[model samples]
Target: MSNVLRIALVDPSDGSREALKGKLLGMDTIWLEADCSRYEFFPDVIEQTAPDVGVITLDSNPEKAIELIQRLATSAPDTAILAASEQTDGQLILRTMRAGAREFLTLPLSSDDLDEALRRVSQMKFGSADAGGRSCEVYAIAGATGGVGSTSTAVNLGCVLASEPQNSVALLDLDLALGDADVFLDSIPDYTLADVVQNISRLDIQLLKRSLTKHSSGLYLLPRPVELQDTLSITDDSIRKVIGLLKASFTHLIIDLSKTYSSVDMAAIESATRVVLVTQLDLPCLRNVVRLMMGFEEIDDLHNKVEIVVNRAGLETGQISLKKAKETLGREIFALLPNDYRTMVEVRNNGVPLIVQAPKAAITQGIRELAEKLEKGSSPAAEAGEEPAKASESKWKKFWPGVKQ
Candidate 1:
């Protein structure tokens, strides 16, 4: 045993504390300090012993465990925290992560789990010192509603950026339940955002890269699990930590946000340097866009950072002309993507991004052009009469090859 990995166990039960201490004793390199249940002892223990790790046991109630974690983080940011809970759920896991746990383990603990946690903590300590000058940038994409093609746009945008030689990009799927960035890009990561949250405190660039699923295009995807039952809930702090880790490892970070607003979503949006709000040219879509835009405006800082993207821009609905639609909103359409159901359908069914499968199609061209404009920093103009940028579309062309419009 190295005696370098000092540890602290925080469990109300004396039996569990002794058991945990015994487990640590097996490792030659690990040193067990005080077994404390009272929060009052934490600062004193930490100040005197300076343990490398702190494990909080969540037996009957987790709220106290969470509070202890927050206090420890404030007093001892250097200490790695592992939360052990008898009750584990998406929401509880999220709560633990946000409260400052580096790792969350279910009860009936094993040596294997404890060993892994210790290894991760040790690696985090060393990784931070070796990370050097790496930094990340944030990009956000949101749809006006269901059909604005924000997912597709975000997928391709990340792919395009990652395709650049010497550049790394991470695509974060923030849609808790229905995200398809992983499916679209054909990425199956071993871990999801849930895993990231579960292990957020110890997350450094190296750990983050390990969690990412690499795509052929060189883009890395942090996906939401396919099973909604799987953990997806994340807290603001966990989201920040995940983003912080990505920012250290990648040059570009693309976030696909859920249409519904949540604190997690707000954190991602706030962290982003640019926000692409995707919408379409229909009254219903526009009305929804109006509400979203107004809602965003309520947050003064975010309004200026948002860019409007009009999907399926030129679709004529006889009810309202493109020019009229633009006039209704006060801002210009940042980009206009054409509608092509066949290509979209094919892309979705094939589990491939539209840009990769149909780069020459009109919709693809529009997307590519939009990407180019974003690269250049010029916002595309909305058709006349639509709102300038109400804050906020496209196609299934390939999937339904036999169907004709």
Candidate 2:
């Protein structure tokens, strides 16, 4: 296998098909050669091109594209699937991810996104060889339902984890539209995850870092789109590309999962090291979590990795007790957070992570506890502190628990 990243662009739309292919060709460093012939039928196209990366810009027959992705995952396990966006829908995004799409690209492409996507593909090819596949963790943070503090929890947890001096973390705000991760952190990012999707063919570490907005706290944030009209859709190839890019740069990655079950959310969850389901003391949230946990259990390899996080845990609400909640779900409560209105209001007004503004508060304390739990639950980092200089063992040795190679 040569270093050149072979790419196949499959799309029925003439404009998107030509535009995407042309953009990849124009990039000088990315050795991307496209076989656009896959636009006819993705399955047939994959058979003929057998590219390392496959790009699907299908707007008319999305189901067909999904079918092709599912078929290709088994037929060609090495080929990465990328999907171009015409619009953004939570269900569509999740469905695509579960169907085997790696990433999604929103319309009105950006040069940075294209550049980064290509770099991601190249890295994925090499990283797989370095290990058995790739060295990364996928952390999924999903709301039990809407307005249960999932976005806030995801953002703060990621920010706190990223704040550790020696550890690098990437916080991905996966809620395509109406995602408030930027607002929560009070950051004015130049780019969002949507940019990464549109330019899935040219992603690299340098480009990925450039796309990020680094906080003084040392956290790398990939924000969501500020504009309500902007679309974000990615394919398996693009998701893999972006995830691979993040993995190379950061030791820990925390993903803010979209509340709605769509192709995008599923893709993010599959790539996550752990899935954190954030719930509140309410029937709606608990019921939703119950349903979602059941749904996750149906998927292979996901049931064991899913963790239920009870946010705003202690309240005078008519809900199941903590023990009963765990009994009902048949899983342990990963963590419990107290409901603190004063701190939440203050942090919301300041537009900063609660951990930064209220370190000693109940919620913040719980978050810190959760962070430490995650750090310990993993390998080498647990034996040593979070600092790399303090590591007594090799990084590879630390990774022995999950390292297959």
Candidate 3:
């Protein structure tokens, strides 16, 4: 099986088809390789896309759906079939399952329900398809204050990590209403977090990937809502669900969060394997970093998980020295990006990450070094405490909850 599980959608209902397509795109793991209006076309679409699973919508013609499921079972025995309909009848479900469908979902699928159904079907058929999947790392980037380069750090970090062919990265714009993380990479995603929130009921791994805008750097982007009002609809539960799903598929999951604190932001922090606290060398930014560190310290070892990243370092002489910042924040400086407004603006205007547009730039090199440290499982020498030597065991174990090889 490909690292990404390929899927095909067959639904005549325009609303359902479009909704399903949006949801599938939101997922980083499930690839929507085919979409046809009729099950009659499943054979042809399947032949072309060679999907591992067929999400066949069975609302209009249950009998035909059943027939197609049976036929596909016989002809394309390798392809798994999942049936969905608005029908709640136990009989309808039984009929579809009896016809060789691996799973069934009622129509207008909720994200939670779809995710559960797919998980069951995957476990049954692939039996730990993620056994060979990359060891996942999740990083959450937050700025001490707005315009502190957190989004840039998160975007470029994800880009460089994914620059390696073997790595898959998901960069999520969690700034919600005012998020412009996509602007940093110049990605205009068709579906954003707003779409995911609106269709949360029907979201699954495949649907989530469909929502993301894939960048030239091979990093997938889950941008925030376009309409500011839409942000109000997103709940902390949805944030948790989104991050949880991203962790399952991508090798690296980077989140760019809003500067201000919120319930959803806290949820992301709780789930993050590491939090990069991006700050500039100004006094106010340093003060906020100290305050943030205090907040992090309240939680046992959360302070350790947080690594200070000073952006635009050495841009201005006689600024708060790294030594003073560390003394104030009581944590080591994890990374220092050089000030390069020209290179940064150029790349942002071009809609590309620094690593892609100007690989040799100082800021780009800084981001790359951070990525390398992450890959090598090393912490900066100044990082607070001796326990970082054991960080991977404590951090990585949370992502993969339970699955035997």
Error of 2 at 238 (Å): 2.3
Off by over 4 Å in 3: 1-133, 378-405
For model 2, the superposed segments whose C-alpha errors exceed 4 Å read 1-134, 235-237, 378-405
Q: lDDT score of model 3?
A: 0.78
**Weakest 10 consecutive residues of candidate 1 by summed lDDT:** 391-400
lDDT of 2: 0.70
Residue-wise lDDT of candidate 2 within 127-150, one digit each (tens)?
A: 643222223455788888888888
CA lDDT scores, all candidates in order: 0.73, 0.70, 0.78
What TM-score does each of the candidates earn? 0.60, 0.60, 0.65
lDDT score at residue 268, model 2, on the 0-100 scale: 76
Supply the global lDDT for candidate 1: 0.73
As a TM-score, model 1 comes out at 0.60
Q: Against the true structure, whose TM-score is highest?
A: 3
Candidate 3 residue lDDT tens string, 273-302: 788888898888887775576566456657
Q: After superposition, how far is residue 224 of candidate 3 from its true place, in Å?
A: 0.8
